[model samples]
Target: LPTSSSSEDFHESSSSESSDGTSGTPTLEPVPSPVPEPLCWEM
Candidate 1:
């Protein structure tokens, strides 16, 4: 379940990043993972 864990971690970090104005970094990581596309775009 590495992907699941990684996605969760990405979300947690992304949430924090969203408040910091550096959200782009987290979104970029998920761009290559098709499953995370929606999540990334939503952020």
Candidate 2:
């Protein structure tokens, strides 16, 4: 479950204040993400 910590960190960063959470959803599959921004967030 520790691997999920990486996803948690994304939520803590720019998306922490993200109200809709819709934007954050794509982070779940950042492996095939089209946007560099979301890919960056995944890391």
Candidate 3:
């Protein structure tokens, strides 16, 4: 966890933000990519 914490710190360094509304990073929702339909064979 410590390593992860350090990595998070590094990320924070690269990123400008604070726990308090400082970052203003947009909250983006994940959108699913369209999947191709499988081919159907007639019996």
Cα displacement (angstroms), candidate 1, residue 7, comes to 0.6
lDDT of 3: 0.48
Q: Which ten residues in a row have the lowest lDDT in candidate 2?
A: 24-33
Spell out the clash pairs found in candidate 1: none
- Writing each residue's lDDT as its tens digit, candidate 2 over 1-43 gives 7779988887677567554667666654563556777768899
lDDT for position 5 in model 2: 91
Q: Taking the tens digit of each residue's C-alpha lDDT, what string does model 1 give over 1-43?
A: 9999999997777566675677766666666676667777999
Which structure among the candidates has the greatest lDDT? Answer: 1
How do these models rank on lDDT, best leading?
1, 2, 3
- By summed lDDT, which 10 consecutive residues of candidate 1 come out lowest? 23-32
Model 1, position 9, has a per-residue lDDT of: 92
Which of candidates 1 and 3 reaches a greater lDDT?
1
lDDT of each: 0.73, 0.67, 0.48
Error of 3 at 9 (Å): 0.4
